[model samples]
Target: MLSSALKAYVNAIDDPYTIYMDTEQNSGFQEELKGSSDFEGIGAVISKKDYYIQIDEIIKGSPAFAAGLMMLDRVVMIGSGLTKGLDVNQAVSQIRGPK
Candidate 1:
């Protein structure tokens, strides 16, 4: 469950669903899960001139968000590194830290 403050913050966004996940359980452990892999590399899509970067959405009160990262902020750079040639998976891997 999301805290009230977090919910409020999500509600303030243009796309709150971007931060929400479905928790409904269709069956017990016996059933295979669907759409689980969909969350693996999800990120905000930002377009600038003809380039884009996927920004991993950190938690509500995280330093990233506090620094101005929104649901879909154009992630032009990660730290001192530019996101120019990195693919979505590479970018996500970098943002998620070491494996």
Candidate 2:
């Protein structure tokens, strides 16, 4: 309701990284930062930028690094679908696991 509106309004502004997280989300984010790569992935740091998820960093020796996915690479598609309208959270979920 109100929270969603506020979040949407804030995210609508110029700051692409501006975001809102609940207690569960905050805790999950912290946990995800500490060795959550047990699952297979390309090993790239992604962030919200320009209405899409952009590669902020590529871990050395990671599959993403091996695949030549460098910093600032715009991820327009995840798997077979386009990322045109997906939010950061949606993109992150899609990016997780073996993909």
Candidate 3:
């Protein structure tokens, strides 16, 4: 459909910064931009480093901070799933959800 078409167009453009986001992806992107609340996430900023995910920041008073998660802590797994080879967005989808 339109999403596929847009994705194809973006792929054709061969620009690393050009990406087509579907409704859910666009919503997530917008929420991240606004730093909005009411979502179900650990409130820790994470990034992929080498083959592992690392915590970059833990928001004050957030569940992550309450759990004693620290910046630079490596994430080995999420629930039953191993975090190896996961991109940041893949890790985020596993972490974030509707409350």
The best candidate by lDDT is 3
Q: TM-score-based ranking, best first? A: 3, 2, 1
Q: The CA-based lDDT of model 2 is what?
A: 0.68
By lDDT, the candidates rank as 3, 2, 1
For each candidate in turn, the TM-score is 0.41, 0.58, 0.61
Worst 10 residues of 1 by lDDT: 24-33
Runs of candidate 3 with Cα error greater than 4 angstroms are 1-35, 97-99
Least accurate stretch of 10 residues (summed lDDT) in model 3?
A: 25-34
Which pairs of residues collide in model 3? none
Q: How accurate is candidate 3 locally (lDDT)?
A: 0.74
Model 2, position 54, has a per-residue lDDT of 79
Question: What's the residue-level lDDT of 72 in candidate 2?
Answer: 73
**1-99 per-residue lDDT for model 1 (tens digits):** 465465456557857344432232112111222334333322232222235674424444545556677755667787689988776556656665653
For candidate 2, the C-alpha RMSD (Å) to the true structure equals 5.0
